[model samples]
Target: MIKVDNLSFSFPQKELFNNISFTLEEAQHCAFIGTSGSGKSTLIDILMDPERYLFDGKLEMDPDCTIGYVSQFSELDNTKETTVFEYIGEPFIKLQNEIQSICTEMETSTDIEPLLEKYQFALDALDAIGGDDFESNIHKQLNVANLMKRRDSKVADLSGGEFKLIQVMKEMLNRPDILIMDEPDVFLDFENLNALKKLIHSYKGILLVVTHNRYLLNHCFNKIIHLENREIQEFDGRYIEYNFSLLQTKMELQELAVAEQEEMERNDTIINNLRVIATYNSDASRGRALKARVRFQERLEARRIKAPFVEIKQPNISFGVDNEMEDAIVVSVHHYSVGFDELLLDNVNFEIKSTDKVAIIGANGTGKTTLLRDIFKNNHASIEINADVKVAYLSQLQGEMLKDANTILEEFIDAGFKTYDEIGLYLFNYGFEGETLSQKIESLSGGEKNLLQLAKVSASKANVLLLDEPTSHLDTYTQLALEKAIEKFKGAILMVSHDFYSVVNGMDYVLIIDDKTIRKMTLPKFRQMIYDSHFDKDYLETEQKKKSVEMKIELALKNTDFELAKGLVEELEELIKWL
Candidate 1:
């Protein structure tokens, strides 16, 4: 069991957690969930680095038991240029090194028995962690994860989803006593996500996940460790039940708090009335009544309830409609093809009529972003569109595009937005203010840059949108705001996204990119296709590029580095010009 008692932690400005306590026993799976900056990540980091953080706590953990971690956005240390096989067999690699050292020691002395004992211990350790048959077990694990096919691939070159899968596989290869996953749902598509779910379910070790995905929280975890009001709240069951209980608790609190507030207000009013009457009467006997009323007001104030603030500030997003255009098909692609050195799709045909919301989805590196770029580049190509179709592209490369640009004030002014205060007010609505409005564009974090880019794109008066991974880095509340903003938009949107929650509920139709073919399928059809392993090996295959220029373009645009974007966009135009 991993026991935590009487834990409290503080930063320079605020006390993050107070008297927090929890435990994870064998066979118990729980999750730590809270609002943004509530120390969910900090708590996990402290767990991994017990020697570093100084806090008041009593932690009881078995010395021999091993702990494994999967970071939310952390990448593997690929400094050694590791391969998939080597990365997955890292534990065995360490074991073999130890065994070799013991054998070398045997060569110098007449201690054969000791060497043999050491060797046997190492082998037994491996068997105990994974399985008895070493080679067979390795093959089975790798095969199940689909890493065997890419066994020789460099670990550094792996896609985010692929890297996450391999990371999980490595932990599973040497089953730790406790496994902690921090936001495992971030970059995963439908295919990789299901595989992870299966692996988690089948693992015998205790599991703890920190995620904002409600679907994942409900399906994977059995317990909820909620961080709220600087206190740790524990629930014995899954999220749905805990949510219902939390709702009831809040309702009870609201009733008590409201009653307290009402009583205090009534008492204050009585005092005011007594003072007014005493002033008018000018009688010495009125002093007693005034004093009594003041005493009652003091008593009410002394017993006032301090109610918890339950509201989380979400971004206020509004995408106004450019009704200048007539209602007609905004975008039409016919007999078009898109790819680089490798072909991803061929003779694809699709139409965005009026204000359709189309989601482009496929496995990782399967031309979703490329398809968006293709549609965007066709502004100068043969792709037909209504004369009034004003297309605004939100590339993943927007950050790179705007990286070297001037301050937010300059960018806003350059974009034709008049007045610094006007831009400040506009940005303030999206969570930026006075000094922040004058801050340099590059100074913002990746997520902040993403939000700013989102604000810029949604602010456009364009009648059509071509967005790629716009919600990948946004917080849940911001994502909800974006969804509402999209709902408010009267323009056509063709977005490339792996955010299943947003795509599943927000988009009207899905454009599935598979096997060099494009199919406009219903949302249910696309979900069913990815949910089950119905397709063969050759079907969902992808050829990942050395570096995705598309992402660079999006980032550059966000960074306002238009000089870099121009060349990159031109190169992108040249490469995908082939059938």
Candidate 2:
């Protein structure tokens, strides 16, 4: 129901999109993906309100279409005393209040005709939203989100992640023609994430979600709109298939580029020989041959392979250590209990050995962030840290750790960088450039802020890192890079995260908090727990075979063996059928 044509947008320092176009139709779920700070969120804002910006584009949307949006950093007003049920039914409540006001006015006003018309319109709007049964619908949604117990709880009292999900529920129940969610899965626990997945899958209207969560990307989207290098690539398939196609194309391009290079080298040698002969003998034909070869070289250069996808840039993230601990427990917590109004964690014990990578996992409101904060502070009597260990922390609430009023350069300067050149040089590795360094941290996107946090962590030279939801606002490429960095780090790590792929791939083991206590679980058991709780019975096996076929197909195509590639395609098709 929406279309963008020849759209181009840029800031003063950088061009975000150039002549990019895509269409969103009814019942289509589109995943908007790109590199960190690639303007995915900016483009969504433009789509929501084209009149708000001066840009070159044609945004054609159905006039009757109503849009529901959930932004990445949205939060509830803490002073407002609204219950979860009332919050989700605000639209319904508003319409009902209008109708009641009109009825009351009709009894006292001389102009009853206008009041009658207004009352009729309000009734129609309320009926359209099913205001009659909105209470029941709200209950059902709360139950689906596993928040039935908190239906009467104040929304402001809910945790950040829970509040985000409630916002989503509010928008969904409004039943707009289009729904756009930016990083809705961020900070969500596993159960809440599962609820979001189900909601996206069951949404009947057009959906445009910006997320880097691998689970959501794999399970929710039917189309992928990838923005990279000021260009857009639209894939009309699942993300898995889209990713495999990109890999296959990269392989083919690389193979063809190599062949072209060899041909160009041969032409260069022939041209040189012809020139040498002409210089020695003054032969006219020799000169003509050299001229013809030069023209051929120009043509080859014009048609050379350009693989933008293959050259997609990811941030160079590396965590440094000043002094690596040797075979000792870097952090130890014994009989640790932390909570505010109620007991969340009671006498939980966990330890991180030197060079060990551990993940602390639990449900929402189970004191995961609280425990991490306690460790970072190292102030509790039950917590112990090695005297020689240094620490760095990446908070899930990036804004809390970052000064909002400070510019990027100023933030770094305050963080202990001595000179402008040093700060610029260091920030460049995290994708911050010269002009962007002058921008305030509050003006930056969520992903950009997270990258800034990572840069700070890397520069700390700490032997132990406490990372909480590090992959939340990062792009897929950055997330992969972080996994690599985590794998290569030379110190002990304790992370609190809900990202399944990051936890499974990067962490050595898991410390699961359950029933107010801590329990250690091996990676194998953790993997099985995820599969049993969320995935299909044969998903793991099917994914392995699919990956194998995809690689085989890439190789076959690169070698110009069409028959082998076709056979591999058939095998992949069969695997997809089972999926």
Candidate 3:
């Protein structure tokens, strides 16, 4: 459990938040929701003591409780060769050593036999907590984070998603009583998001998660704490309830300010009349009335003014005319296989018609990105032909494109875009303004980087767009705005996104890339497929049977029934092979 009392923080010229007070009881999950630059990440940094931002607060915690924090970026030391298991298990090594020391000290005493037994008991307790199933826990964490296959891969070779997941796994393995996560769902797909939800549901600890994904917040959190106008307020329901509460509060405050202004005007008129009467009659009574009127004026001046209203603005994009189509193909892949020696797509044949809006969907690592890359490479190879189409690819980890040496405005210019005034106007549409446009790209957050990528793509005037996980870090409002832009685009679109809402609500056709093949379906049919696939009894029954066999073997081993466990394992192996 944790509590914050009288917390206030301010920057050089502005207060970020003030008088913030809240209590997070054990096992309670809470989410922080706000617009960009609204101090969501700043609050997390203050809690975690990362940047020592100015603050006056008392953060009280249980004496023995531990806190684990996961950042948006993973900063593992790449110079050292470390395995996934070692990385996860590193947290417990200190406890393991302490247990060893206790045992050694008790071993040399004859009169300390009971003490030795106590130390043995303590060691067993620690092992039971995390040591016994450490390996399995690592696997489960990696699986939940969608980094299972990359366990043996080096940290340097991981995709952005895999790296972020590893950070999550490392924090989970620490088994702290309180977990503070910033943008925990940055690169996760649907399957991994569900897995993370289930894991959080099962956790018996406190979670303070900051994320822009509404689905994750709606599914995982019961409390929503909003930061607005340099203050914090807690809502006791889901994200929708919190959002409605904020709207109502804002409306009430606006009405109150109006009434207050009217009252002030009325008081001013009464004071003016009293002053005129006192001017007409100079006496003790007149002096007393004047003093009383001045007191009212002072009281009026002491009242705090309501904070100004600020609304988050989104990017406005108007795509140009669609390019003319010719006899030559825009995109074609023939017998293409891509991956690290493993074929993700095999003998795949696909073509993109001019001005086609294609949605790529699959489980994580099923070659959606590979297909996009193939298209871009194919298009680049045919650039000499007049019929060849221009392709622009937007990656999920667009943050990597930002350089410290260039401001966002400079980066736009460096990317060969003309018209500084036009670029500044475009950036303003995407929420960048004045000082923000002058800020280095490296100073921007993940969400800001995503906006920059959108700006760059829009300015390029490319005939084809290849976007991979474009909505991964975007908030719902921004995602909807981007979806609108995509819908208005007249050129060819080949996008790979795991945001199911975007696919179902935006794209015309869904392309399921799996089992080394690309299967195309319409958005309506794909939604039906998702529905039927989940609710079908026969399918559920088959999956249940498979899980049943695995559970039986696990139970047998736990009970020390070797013969039965071996038989069950063999049967499970046979079933797996047949499948």
Candidate 4:
């Protein structure tokens, strides 16, 4: 258990939090929710005692408590030659040494022998924690993060998502009483996300998580703590309740602000009238009038006016001519196979017709993006295609494309767009206006760059669009706006995405790729396939029984029945083995 009392923090140019207070009891799970740049990460950093930050508060914890933190970014030594088993087992190695020391210091007895048995017991525990299958777990994490298959590969060969998952798995293996994870679900696929949820549910500790994923937050968080306007506020219940409560609070604040402004205006008018009359009256009357005016000013200053909340505006994309083409195949992949060593995609054949919206779906690392790139390359290679079939490609991190540019307008001009007015209009539609449009591209954030890229694509006269993970960095509202835009587009679209909600809502056709093959299906059929594949009768029954047993054991342990708890633990172990 831990408590933070009257905590305040600020950076050089901005105040992050002021007089924030919160508590995390034993086994409690809390989530920090806020918009981007609201200082969630800074608060976490202060709690974790990271250098280069200042803290002005009291953080009280149980003297024996141990903390384990998983950062958003992972730092792995590329040259260490450490296998996954050794990597996760490193934490237990220290425990094993301590156990050995205790055994050596104690006299020989039955108790000593039982206690000494813990060294070997710890080894078995490590294996049961998946140490023996550590390599497999690492592969699973990497694959779920969409990294290529490279079991013996160095960490340097991994992408940002891959490294982040590896760091998370490492922290989980430590089994600390206080776990702080920052955005664990950011790069994971559905399968791995479920695995992480199961693991967190099974954990017996205090969990403080920071994430933007609504699904994970809704499922795992028991309470939400929001940081806004240099203050912290707590909301009870799941994400849905918290969101609703937040909206209600914002509306109330806005109403109060309107009332305060009206009062201030009324006071200003009275003060003005008093001043006008006092000028023609005696000195005593003038002095009283000036005093009244000062009091009114003080009252106005005392009124707590909430700062206006700025909402990011959605883009208005107008699709040009809806000239449906019967023979226009925007993209075609014929007998295509791609891999680093082994085949990831094989004999993949697909064709995109004009006005068709196709969603490429697969388990992570199944070469969805590779397939898109192949299609783009093939389209570029074709010489017989018409000149009017203009294509625009949006990569996963499209912002990186503008790193060298001085300004967004300059980048747009360099990208061969004609007019600044047209570019400004497009930027405004994507939530960038006036000063933002003139901002240097090198100084823009990831989300800002993403908006700029979308604006550029919308301004282009391209009829065929290729988007890879377009919605990954976007918020829920922006994603919905993009879905609407895609629906309005008259051109063909080839997109690869893992966001299930967007896939279900926006995609017209689904292409499932696996083991170097592609299978085409309608959206309805794809949903059914995924559901039926994951929730077969046998698996459902097993999962139900597993949950029942876990609940029973938890209830028994709550009553301080040690013998029953020990027995239940053993039974649970056996059940896990069976599973």
**Which one wins on TM-score?**
2
Candidate 3 runs further than 4 Å off: 5-15, 18-21, 62-64, 75-87, 101-170, 228-231, 244-312, 321-329, 377-388, 417-421, 532-579
> Which segments of model 4 are wrong by more than 4 Å?
1-21, 54-66, 75-81, 94-166, 228-231, 246-327, 378-386, 397-400, 404-449, 531-579
Tens digits of per-residue lDDT for model 2 on 208-273? 999999999988999999998888888999987787678657656766787899999999999888
Residue 334, candidate 3: how far off, in angstroms? 3.0
Better of 2 and 3 by TM-score: 2
Q: What is the TM-score of each candidate against the true structure?
A: 0.76, 0.94, 0.72, 0.66
- Tens digits of per-residue lDDT, candidate 3, 7-114, equal 888766446888888888876888877655667887787776624766687877777777788877756565757666666667566567777787787778777877
Model 1 Cα lDDT, one tens digit per residue, 1-579:
788898999876557888889888888788777654567777887777778888997877888878898876666565658888888887787887887798788898786887888889987886776544545656676677666787878887677788898888777777788899887766677777766766677677788887766456656777888875678878888765665455344445555666788887887888788788887797877888888878877877787555333444677887776664556888888877766667777888888887789998888767777778767776625477777777778777655446546787787777778888778888887877656676688655445667777777766777788888877546566787888888778778998887776787678999887787778889877655654463334322210120266567657755656667667755554433320
List runs of model 2 lying over 4 Å from the truth. 108-110, 545-577
Cα-based lDDT at residue 242, candidate 4? 58
Model 1 alpha-carbon miss at residue 292, Å: 5.6
Residue-pair clashes per prediction, in order, are 29, 0, 0, 1
| TM-score between candidate 2 and the true structure | 0.94
Which of the numbered candidates is closest to the native, going by highest lDDT?
2
Scored by Cα lDDT, where does model 2 land? 0.88
Candidate 3: worst-modelled 10 consecutive residues by lDDT: 379-388
Best first by lDDT, ranked: 2, 1, 3, 4
Cα error of candidate 3 at position 443, Å = 1.3
lDDT of 1: 0.73
lDDT (Cα, tens digit) per residue for candidate 4, span 401-519 = 56545688889888777898977876676666675567677655444566566766776657888788776545455666778888888888888876666677678988887556988
Please give me the total number of clashing residue pairs in predicted model 3: 0
- State in Å the error of residue 65, model 2: 2.1
How many clashing pairs in candidate 2? Answer: 0
